[model samples]
Every structure is written in structure tokens, then in C-alpha cells.
Target: MKTTNYDIIIIGGGMVGASLACALADSTLKIAVIEGREPPAEWPADSFDIRVSAITRASENLFRHLGAWEEMQRLRVQPYQAMEVWDATGPGHIHFEAAELGEPNLGHIIENRVITRALRQRLREHHNIDYRCPAHPKGLLPLIDRAQLQLDDGSRLQAPLMVGADGAHSWLRQQAGIAVAERHYGQTAVVTTVQTEKHHQDTAWQRFLPSGPLAFLPLPGGRSSIVWSTTAEQAEHLLALDAGEFMAELGEAFAHRLGAITALGPRGAFPLKGRHAKQYVKPQLALVGDAAHTIHPLAGQGVNLGLADVEALAAVVLDAHRARRPIGALKTLRRYERARRGDNLLMLDAMGAFKSLFSNDTPGLRELRNLGLDLADHAGPVKNLIVARAMGLDALPAASLATS
Candidate 1:
């Protein structure tokens, strides 16, 4: 088999892996990014992609630093100035406005395709980065000093560090003998784009029903992308319904908060689960993105967390390389793990608690949650703290300076 060598091997070319490569663009390290499938040359300009991400400011900074933000803006992005979250069953509601916090906007919602397309564009400009699409990993062998990956083409690539960004079901994680703690939420997220009778008004609206939270995130052109998390059975039923029937049910469930659902786009569904790797690093192998952890989407922080991982890992790796240290050494990689594991765990637990608290129908619990929401709404300091953290501006992680 043909053999190639590199300083770093990144598995998966989704948003996370691609972002990591871009984060390291200034480095001299030879990097290989392997992705099994290639994205389309272009998406339909008239319609938005069903999958979208609520990008926090910190993540936006990282993209900007990588020089991809301009192209992304040219393609399309929707900025939400405010957010409204309330309980569907009770009189509990909380509103967050960017003006209240002296920020221009809460965050921007962009389609997943836009993110990947932009990142890939940045990858092309870096001479040291080799993005290999249409390549699948067939085998992995981890030695004391390096981990070797065998692609389906019968070619082998060896790297001092192998980073897994392959997502929740990470093949690299499994090959490295890393185990994950997983929780199946027994929920499926049904996603689609729709036009409402009322304009979204640059706001993100979410209602926590007994089943799960339903989020209406504004898209450009007065349309909204909806993520409705519900029981697997209910999701199946919802998908089985005709477009008109589904739109009617969706309108009723949302209480016509945006007047009515006037049009529907393509619909898709995926099961929900929480997963965290038992170990984030093993000698020459390390994991990032969904390969490290995945949380419930109730808070819309999953991609943000993954971007933070990229920033932290890039810092440690680049710092070590500049210092003439072994970037793949366990000690060197541990810095990335230590910086991210705690934050990721906290988010995972918080989402789990929120899901438990809001997904129940107990009368006493309902009253308590409503009261808690009211109290939080009234508590300015507490409310701002929550929003700041979600916007990823509170701690100011390596994302702000990692590329510098």
C-alpha cells in the first residue's frame, strides 16, 4: 500500500473538522483532512438547507479569524436580535433582547451547508492542509509514537496525532479503544423550513411542550427553520402526515405564535442522544467535536461547544509545535482535554436537567418550573449571565486569540 506521512490527521470534514483545519492554517504542520462524502457544488439559492446552526459570537470570531466569514455572509445568514422562550403548558415566559445587554444581536442562524462551504473555501488557501474528500477509513493502527490510518483506497497515512471529528458515532474513537457514555433521549428532532403568516421579526422563539422543545429560528426572507423534538413515535406520526396536515398541527402546537404556517419545505427527522467519550485523548490519538461529546439541543449549544473544542485543541497543538514539543504526546494533548472536558460535561448535565424538568407533566413540578422562569426573568444579573454564556462571550475562550 502507498504510505503518506503528516503531522496531523483529521477524520471527518464536517463543520467541526473543517473548522479545526482552518484554525491551524497558520501552522507549519502538515495536516490531512479525510471526509467520506463531498458536499454539493452549490445549494439551491431559492431555498434554505433544512439543517442549521445557531452560531454564537465566539464561534463567529473563529470563522472571521479564518477569513471565511465574508464568503458566508455573501451566501446568506440571519441574525436574531432577540429570543423568547416560554412553557407551552403554563404561564412561564422569558424574553432576552440584545439591546438589553448592549449587544447588536443575540446570534446568527446559518445553514450547515453555508458553514461547510465557507470553511472548505478557507481550506483551499492553506498550502499545508490537504483536504481529501471521497476517502473512507478502513483501518487504524495506533503505535507508541504515531497513529496510522488506512483508507479504502489501500493507501496508509501516518500522523503523529490523529484527531477524530467524525461525530457521535466516531469510527476513529472506536478504533482507538475509546468508549463513550451514551444516553438515548427517546426523542427525535423533526426539522423543516416554513413561512409563517407573521414575520419572524429577527427573533428566535421556543416553546417547551410536554413532549419536548420546539424552536422557530428565523431565516432570511421571512422564513423560519423549525426544530421540533418529540417522542420517536410522535415524530414518526408527524412525518407520516401530509404537508397540509402537518402544517396545521404545527400551527396549533406553536399556538400560532407567528400567526400561521403558510408554507412547508422538505422535512427530515433524526433521533436524539447524549454521548461523551470516556477519554478525550490516548497517547497519539485525540478526539474533538461530536466525537468528544454531544448534548441535547434544547440550548442550541452543541456546535458552539464543538467550535470551542477546535479552538482549545488548536491552541495546545500550535503552542506545542512552536515550542519544539511533541504535539501528539499525551501530556501535550491533555491540555486540550482538561480545558474542554469540564465545560462540555457541565453543558451535557445542564441540558439533561432542562430536558427532565421541562419534559414532565407533574402538576407540582410544572408550578415550580413556571415560578423559576418568572424569577429568572425578573433577576437581571442571572438572566444576563445565562445569555452571555450562551452567546459564548462570558469566558472568552481560546477562540478569541487561538489563531493569533
Candidate 2:
């Protein structure tokens, strides 16, 4: 078969991979992207994609650096000025306002599809990047300095660095003989959008119930996007409900905080599980995003975590290339792995702790957590620290978090 060579080949064209492509666009390195799905031709400026994320200021800055944030802004991404978290069993609640941090907004809630499309557009503008859609890597062979990839088409590509941004079931990671530690939470996430009777006032709200956490993220219009996490059986039942019944049930579930839920869009459910690869990099291969680790979406930091991995990996690769060192050298890749492993583990542990803490039915534990929230709310310095952490400022001291 024929063989083409590239400086780097990324095996997933999702936001993380595409952002990595864009970040490396200005460099002379030749990048090839292998994606199973093609990007949309155009983004819907006013519509909402069922999958949305609460983008932190740090992630937003990374998007800006990649030249995709302006396009996201053009697509009418909604900036949430405040976040309110409460529990059903207690009067304890907490509110985080962006003004406390001297920022205009806490974070931006954007449709996943819009961000993906914008990243694709940026990738297209880069002459050094080559994107292959509906393609898969058949196999990978690591060489002394570069790695060779065998595509399903029987074609071959060689690169000094090979990245697996594919997902939780990363084919590249498996092919590299890397093991993963996975745990099934037995929960599923039901996501959809609703047209509420009252405006959200640019506030994102989350309510902790005995079953799971339900988040109402404000959209550009008066509508709100809902991410409800519950057990598998419960999620299936929710999905089985008719539009009218679903809206009614959802309104009741949410205690109608935004008033009556008038309209409901299509609902989709994704099984929730936690997985982290035993190793993030080998001789010439590295894993990013979901391929490395996946956390619960209860905090809405899943995508942000993936973006952070991309940022860190890209910075390491760029630095190595500038130093005239092999980008895929074990020493260089180890730097990326070491820098990200602790942060990833920290987030995974935090989400797990939060999930276990909130999922408990014990009265004492409930009271303790609720009281903790109330205490944090009443303590100004504590509240500021929590808000900063949630805003992605305190997660890691990477250069990516520095305000531009």
C-alpha cells in the first residue's frame, strides 16, 4: 500500500483532537487527523445541541488561543453569570457569582456541536493540518523515532508522534497494549432542552436529589438545557415518557423552579462510567481526552478536563519540537503524562467523592454535606475559593489558565 508521512497523527477529530490540530497549526509540523465522523458544514446559530458543556474561563482561553472562541461567540454561546446549587432535603444551598472574581461571567454554556464545528473550521484554515473523515486506524507500529499507522483503507501514514483522542474505548490505546481501569456507575445521563416560561437570568442551577443530580443550564434564549443523571432503569423510564408527560414529570422533578416547562425536545441517554488508562503514553504514542480518563458529568467538567489534557500535551510537544528533541520521545511524553496524571486523578477522586456523598440516603451524611454548603455560602473567603476552583482557575497552575 501507499504510505504518507506526517509529523503528528491524531486519531480523533473531536473537539480535543481538533483543538490540538489548531493549536499546532502555526507550527511547521505536518498534522493528519483521522476521524470516524465528518464535521457539520455549518453551525446553527440560534439552535441548541442536546450535548452542552459549562466551559471554564481557562478552557475558554484555550479556545481563544486556538482561534475558535470567536466563532463560538458568533454562534451565540450563552455566558452564565451565576451558578446556584441546592439539595432537595435541606435548606442548605450555595450561589457563586462571577463578579466576586472580577469577571463578567462565571462560564459560558455552549452547545457541543457548535464548538466542534468551530474547531473544524479552524482546522481547515491550517495548511499544515490534513483531516481524514470516516477513517479509522487499523494498526500502529512504533519505530525508534517515529510511528507508522495502518489505516482501514490499507494505506499507511508515518509520524513522529501519534495521539489517541478517540474516546473511552480508544482503539489506539488498546492497540498499544495499554491497560485501563474502568468502573461502571450503573447510571445514565438523560439530556435535552426545554422551553421554560421564565427566563433563566443567565444562571445555571443544579439540584441534588436522592436519585441523582439534575442540572438546568441557561441557553441564549429563555430556554434551558437539562442534564439529568439517574440509574439505568430510571433513565430508560424517563426516555419512554411521551413529550407532554416527560415535560410534566421533569417540571415536577425540578420543582418548577423556572416555572412551567412548556416544550420538550428529543431526549437522549448515555451510560455513565469511569475509566482511566493505566498509562498515558508509550514510546511514540500518547492518549488525550476520554482516552486517558473520563469523569462523571455531575460537575460539567468532563469536556473541560479533556481540553486541559489537549492544552498540556500540545504545550509539551511544541516545547520538545522547539528544543529539537523527538516529540514522541519517552522522556518528553513522560513530562506530559506526569503533569496531567495528578490533576486527572484529583478530579476523578473529587467526582467520585461527591457522587458517593450525595448518593447516600443516610440522614447524617446528608445533613453534614448540606451544612457544609451552607457554611461555605456564609463564609465569604471560603465561597470565593470554591468559586475559583469551579471556574477552573484553581484546578491546575498551567500557563493555559493565565488570563490573556
Indicate which candidate wins on lDDT.
1
Backbone atom clashes (below 3 Å) for every candidate: 0, 0
Q: Candidate 2 — which residues are off by over 4 angstroms? A: 43-46, 395-404
Any idea what lDDT model 1 has?
A: 0.91
* Over 4 Å off, model 1: 397-404
Residue lDDT tens for model 2, 1-404: 77899999999999888988887767788999999997566645455688998999888888887879899898768999999999888887999888877999999999888898899888888989999888988877777789999999998999988999998889998898999988677689999988898899899999998888999999987889999999999999999989888898888888889898965467999999999899999988899999999989998888888988887888888888878999988999999999889989888988988888887879999899999989989999988987887788875533642321
Candidate 2, position 128, lDDT: 91
Q: Quickly count the clashes in candidate 2.
A: 0
lDDT of 1 by residue, 43-130 (tens): 6777789899999988888888878899989999999999999999899999999999999999999999999988988888899999
By summed lDDT, which 10 consecutive residues of candidate 2 come out lowest?
A: 395-404
61: Cα error in model 2, Å: 0.5
Clashing pairs in 2: none
lDDT to native, each model = 0.91, 0.87
